[model samples]
Target: MPDSTAPLLLKGYAWLPDLRRRAHDVPAVPVRLLGKRGTALHGKEAVDFFYDEKHVRRHDAMPGPVLDTLFGRGAVHTLDGEAHRARKALFLDTLKDPARVAALARKAQEEWDRAEADWRGRDRVVLFHESARVLTRAVHDWAGVPLPADEEEATARDLVAMVDGFATVGPRHVRARLARKRQEGRLARLIGELRSAGLPPEPEHATIARAVAAHVDADGRRLDPHTAAVELLNVLRPTVAVSWFLTFSAHALHRWPEHRALLAADERHAWGFAQEVRRFYPFAPFTGGLAATDTEWGGVTIPEGSLVLLDLYGHDHDPDLWPDPYSFDPARFTREGVVIGRDDLVPQGGGDPAAGHRCPGEDITLALLAALVPRLARLPHEVPDQDLSIPLSRVPTLPRSGYVMERVRAEAPAPVG
Candidate 1:
């Protein structure tokens, strides 16, 4: 099989699906990535196979560059077995609390309301950049991190850079490395302070940072300050990354204006709209792990230690799974009696989040979007003439213009009957 690392880098999100198309739509497409023989799998059954711990493992699966840029070194993303479970428990406890999720969503809505007022006075605002800052401020407040107002934009940029640069070897990649280094250092210092002085009493709600700072691993050792900082970023960075989906939501509304009225009128439709945006937009192209042992799937043998990739983007866009997959149709999700199977949506990875390698922050992603999308729909703005083209060659790509809007105004309140 031909090496696909170059193609993947050059083609970005189009690489795997194109490969599958060329290969007569094989269930398992053989290829080489990073000089290692890898097999790519898709669909619901593939999700079950890929997430099974006995078949695949995450330890040593993520590349070093990805670790340095996206997930910090020793972050929970790289752990496996008992260590994985123990570390994952921290996220489940912090993120899975309905009260905590609701509180964060409420904070985000408040932040959006405040930001909307500021945007109204401006001639033009880039929704992507502004939404990122809004998310950063809200998550920081929720996480109990005292971010000075002056530093909020810079901090948000660093968080965005980390996600933006992880997949490429360019200036973006260098910026990502520097951002991670700076953030890890700053957070480590904060963790040290919290450890020594203990958490403050002002924030009655439980803070994720405080929980991570005090969490003991399966080995009965508290995470070192650096590791604790990494875990903290694991919470902070991904929450801020929700800005990407928010931006995509704006793009969707612009392209399909009819959905806006429905989304604004009904919160359920807004949630459905968020799910469709997550599915339609290219986020994570694929996720992979090393084969734990010899495994067979779709009549192909995956040797022990070989890389096994789940085709996330491809699966979401597969016509067999999503009829007219390319269409930006939120109704596919909002239709009455509709149910989204766990494995059917792999935008953030699939399978059981608590028991598997799937992102635990998935619920928070949905909640933040559910709260923010309707607000975006109700916000009055006009899409400016700019470069809206999303380049497929760039990993974690977005509209070149960052979805600019002009003459922003908040929605008018309904009059009493």
Candidate 2:
């Protein structure tokens, strides 16, 4: 079979689904990636199957370029078995707590309030860029990182650059590499300083930085400074990455203004709106790992060490899973008695968060979106004329124009008599 890497680069989010469609929507679509045999899977079953440690393993699964630019070498995403479980515990402890998630959400709201004031004085502001900086400050503050005001914008840009260039080559990819290097070096020094200080007592709130710094891995050893830095970024980077969903949320509100009033009025509706934005947008196209052993999925044998990719974008948009999948509808998530199944939405990934490779930061992502998107809806601004088009060929795509807004009104109108 011909290699699909070039096609994947060219086709972006459409690559896998288009391949499956041509194969008559088979449960397993065979292909080649980076000169390795690969099978792509979709649906809720695929999510469960892909996440099972006995079926697939993440060790050595991520490409080198990705590790260098996106997740960082030795990041939690590259572990498996007990090592993965142990490393994951760090994130689970710091990120998954209800109280902690709420605190982070509150921080984001605070940052949004401050940024809104700055935006009000400007003629036009790109919501995407502004949101990134806002998230940067909120996440850093919550993570216990001392981000000086002067360095905030540069730090946010580096974080955004890492996510932006992870999937591509050339200039963007170069920037991603440089960005990761700069941040990793900076964070590693911070970790070293904490270590040299003999590890001070953590605060009552238990920040992620302190938890990660003090964490001992499955091997019963604290992570080295570089690895510690990577873990730190694992928390910091994804939180900032929420900026993508935030921008997409803005795009959604612009295209469908009907949801704005309800989003502002109902918190639960805002949560549903956040879920829909995650489901509909093209953030992570797919995620992959290597088959742990000889395995059969959909009656097709996947040899040990073969590449396996779970189609995230396709799964969320699958008609069988979501009725009218292409349509932008938040009510599907807002049904009074309905609860989202763990495997139901694979935007970040699937499976038990505490036990598997599913993103532990998923809660934080949802919380930030829920907190900020409603405020975005409630804010008085107009979408300035620009290129609002989202190109599918760009991995981690956004509106070409970054969703510019003008005529800002940050405060609520006086109550009508």
Candidate 3:
């Protein structure tokens, strides 16, 4: 625990001692950078720096990190200008309507309903992995692929491992690569089927895998299949990467029970909790980069090619940006839940620090969580190890057994006079 003193950024304070302090000076404020080797960024200042386009270009350039090694540098996340827009455009047709999202949500709800029914009156059942299993199947179904019932967790783990993008230290890097391989194998088979179908070459085909396949050099040609394989992996990579946040949001509401009741009883609270959870439990700690050119930040000059990381967790907890930063008050989001159209509180880790990024999928995550978290809370059950301590490091993690939740049999409400 390095000092969180004046003008200093600590290595990782995911368990904030003074969330108020974070809400006070975050994002834009310069904190002292603790010199920890092979550490990921974990401060609001880092978030701001990460959001900067110039800084994003820098993040796009750095090597030895997670996503870069998977796709070599400059996939959609790294590319810029027309090239960026063009590549990104490939997914437009596939993602155009919200119908797919709605159907997926409905599928998820049915599963949650089933989980609650199965766990009624139980002590606790591990839910983190279970929920992952549920949502992964929903997304897999949307992708027009068959997701075997038992393999959902393994597939979800593989997806989470790939998007974790934490290569370079610990077993995290090794695990991520292994997960990538597992996922690549699964996606390869699916792609083969798509190829055999000979469907129209639209953006639907240009799913993340398709986009990677279609990504040509400046000359507008196709990339090798190996490169395309990584892109296919990318399609669902971040989906699971962000799932933990939704899972944590569900855990927070359940562990706190008050939020559960509040959300269930009030439409306003439901919407507000939706926003706060994303702010409070974002999965990505920060994005990484090396400056392309000299840049100015927090009154300090960053020399060309210095490593920069944008910590999304820190930004959500900014003391100045958010009142009682650590407190889980959802009122700040307003009724109907504030749509996250590039505000200061960015959890998806893109856009300008004060502006926005390419986090188009945020709505999808939020909508699903908004629907699911409240329902999961009403399950009338309790998880035994609700107090299982998660680390406050570069990224938050859960134990292998995963989280448990028991169904609490809801007593019939008395009739009101």
Candidate 4:
């Protein structure tokens, strides 16, 4: 197989889909990535195959660069089997509760409401950067991290840097590493203080920090301070990363102004719009796991220990699954009685979150979007002259202008009936 590391890096989200196109839409494409033979699989059935623990495992699958920047060393994302389940339970217990999710969303909405007023005073504001600050403040409060008001913007920038730099080997990657180091050190110190004798009691709703600090692993041992800090960041980083989706939401509304009225008038329409943004936008390109044993799927054999990547971006855009897959239509998700299947529409990973490596924060992502995007649609603002083109060749790409807007004003509340 030809080495595709350069092509994958260069092509970004277009790499796998382009390879499949060249192979006449083969079910699986054999190629080399990072000097290892990798099989890229697409479609719903492939989702099932890739997520099966009997066939593939996450241990050692993520590269060292990814571990240092994105998922910390010894984080739950790197575990397998019983150990994974134990660590995952902590996330599920805290993040999956309805009240907690609502609290996080409410905090985010509050931040957005406050920031909207501030934006009106400025000549221009980058929605992407501003949204990151909003989410950073919200998640910090919701996660019980006690960040000072002045540090929120810098913290948000670091969190964004971690996500922005994880997939590349350039200056962004270096920034991500430094950001992770700074956050991990700060968080580890916080964890130590929380564990010390003089700390106040954990609040009723602020359970994330306390829960992580006190969690016992499958081995019946508490996580080391640094590891606990990593897990805490596992919660913080992804929540703030929603800024990417929110930025994309701004792009969608700018490009298709017709949807704005529907989204602003009806909350359900806003939710549908959020789901479409998740599906249509380019976020995660693909995710990989190593074959635990020899596995066969789509008539192709994946040798044991070989890399197997599930094509998330391709599957979301696959014509067989979505009618007019290229169209930016939200109505496809709004029809009555429609529900997105677990193994389908995986901008995050697929399968039951409790049982698989799927992101436990998926619901949090949707909830934040549900709360914020509607506010964005309703806000009175002008999409100023800017480079709105979203280049596909950049991993984690966004509009070149960061979706700038000006002349911001909040809409008046509807008169009570």
Candidate 5:
């Protein structure tokens, strides 16, 4: 075990890459004990901490941006342990079976069709942030009613601005608080509209919305519209952020004509490919889990009540687990490679994590991606830089100057077949 007194580096998830640690570093996950935080932060070293009870119990110990002063405490992330688990479970119930995924895919196709038509025979279209806005509309539409374009656009803009502040990772994020306050005013106006308009019919469309409509807590009361609005806005962060993943993956296949063949060779191929794309280009490489109780893990001790960040990107790319840490390997998910999760093991809060706060939109994202990847491929087009790896700096970059390529229009339907 390393000495407990060793000077510990407190690099948030942002600095993981600079440290040169990948998925397979240290024989197992590192459970760095900062002084007295040994027993409280258990599972930091578990071969699979995703499912470890100790890990789940250390909820508040994880790091996260504080909520706005106006809202106080609302969502599961703001609450710890039992309260979080209970609330999260209720929200998760809506995604237990994600049939809405297909609808969202169809919706995505419709939006793309519209966008393409608007291209007006232009060979390329610059798209990055626009793709996310498109998905937001789909998600919102799936929940019940199509959002007014203006409202949807406003929310998407606010979400991006707020998150930009968090990514700053320090005093800068604090500076962003004022901007966040102003944005909240706009959000309040939107919520007022939703409340007066009534919730829509898309039950499984989004967990928070669905829960607000269907859930009855121990008190047997559903969420008020204001609380519902806060939760709803929170969901947008991951959903739209995922837009980057979808765009990056599309960017990869479009650039590398060979990948189009790979995508075509098998229809069932996209799921695994998508997973790898997520792992390969993890937008948010790491997240923190605070130690609620003192815990000992991986032969190291972490004192109680300490903040610990997990280097998901580092661990995913660790040399021990990945032969070439920097190389992009989509098939790493095969039975041989490390699978971060299973039904029994759940460490992370988002998708693949335990039942507690799994990303409800996992299916929504997959289905939308599945349709988009194949459709773009089946059609004909070529764009320069289609194969270029996403640059290190484009937090979520895609071909914005437009995909410079010609379309291979689909052949007219055969006379009989």
Candidate 6:
């Protein structure tokens, strides 16, 4: 098989889907990546199959570049089995708890309010950059990480760099590596300082940084300072990364102006709008794991130790699964009493988050989007003439012009509850 590493780089999110299409829409498509045998699977069934720990393992599956740029080494994303579960408990507590999520949402709204006020005076503001800063402040303040006002913008840039540069080789990749090293060092020192000061009286009441500082793994060992720093970035980076979705939300509202009225008028519609933005936009292309054992699915066999990629982008846009999948329609999610299936609409990963490799911050992502995107729609701002075209060839692509806005009306409506 021809190595797909170059094609994947050139084609970005469309690579796997286009490959499967050319192969007559096979359920399992075999290929080579970096001289290693690999298979990519599609559909909701594939999500369940890929997440089954008996069939696949995440340990040692991620590329070194991904570890260095996106998820840090020793981060929860790299763990599996009991160790994964133990580490995941910390995220589940901090990210999944309803009250904690609500608090973060509230903080995000407050930060947006402050930033919107500041934007009014500026001639032009980039929604992507400004929103990142808003989320940076919100996550840090909510997580009890002391980010001084002056450092907030720099931190946001670093967080964005880590995600932006993870998928390519170039100056962007260099920026990502340097950002991770700088942040990991900064956060490791903070973890040490908190440990020396002693843990808070109540663990339940503790901040995320404190909780991570004190958490012990399944093997009865606390994460080392560096690993703890990685974990802290695990929390911080994803929240800031939501700026991508938020910016996409701005793009969506501009392209499809009808949704803005619905999103601004009804809170439920805003939730649906958030879901639609995640689905319609390009974010994660796929997630990979190593085959834990020889496994057969859809009449295809995957040998142990081979690469197994669950097709996230393809599955979400699968026409059979989603009628008119290419269309941007929030109403698909807004149907009365419509409950999203665990395996469906996986703009993130799929399967049960608590027991599997799914992102624990999924709830937080949705909540932050639900809380902030509506406010964005309600804010009176003009979309200036700019290059809003999103390139599909860029992994984690965004609007080329960063969705510039000008002639802003700063007197936005009150934050959504």
What's every prediction's RMSD, in angstroms? 1.8, 1.3, 5.4, 1.7, 5.8, 2.1
Write the residue-wise lDDT of candidate 6 on 9-65 in tens digits.
999999999999998998999979999998999988888889999999999999999
Residue-level lDDT tens digits of model 3 in 117-157 = 65675566667666666667667766555678788778877
Model 3 segments beyond 4 Å from truth?
1-62, 68-74, 91-97, 114-124, 163-168, 201-219, 335-341, 352-357, 398-401, 407-417
**For model 1, which pairs clash?**
none
Give candidate 4 misplaced runs (Cα > 4 Å). Answer: 198-206, 413-417
Using lDDT, rank the candidates from best to worst: 6, 2, 1, 4, 3, 5
TM-score versus the correct structure, for each prediction: 0.97, 0.98, 0.77, 0.97, 0.73, 0.97
C-alpha displacement of 291 in model 1, angstroms?
Answer: 0.7
Candidate 4, 142-205: lDDT as tens digits: 8879899889888999999999999998899999999999999989998898778343344334
Q: Per-residue lDDT of 1-417 in model 1, one digit per residue for the tens?
A: 778889999999999999899988989988799899989997789999999999999899999999999998998888899999999999998888889999999999999999999999999999999999999999999998879999999999999999999999989999999999999999999888887887655323457788877888999998999999999999999999998999888888888889878976788887788899999999999998999999799878999999999999999998888999999888898788878788888899998988988999988999999999988988888886898788988899998889999999878887789
Quote model 4's TM-score. Answer: 0.97
Better by lDDT, candidate 5 or 4: 4
Ranked by lDDT, the better of candidates 1 and 6 is 6
Angstrom error at residue 77, model 6: 1.3
- What is candidate 5's lDDT per residue for 177-241, written digit by digit as tens? 65456544544465566556665565444434454544444445665645555665555555555
Ten-residue region with minimum lDDT total, candidate 1: 198-207
Q: Stretches of candidate 6 above 4 Å error?
A: 412-417
Q: Enumerate residue pairs that collide in model 4.
A: none
Prediction 6 TM-score vs. true: 0.97
Give candidate 5's TM-score: 0.73
Query: On a 0 to 1 TM-score scale, where does candidate 1 land against the true structure?
Result: 0.97
- Local distance difference test scores for all models: 0.90, 0.91, 0.57, 0.90, 0.52, 0.91
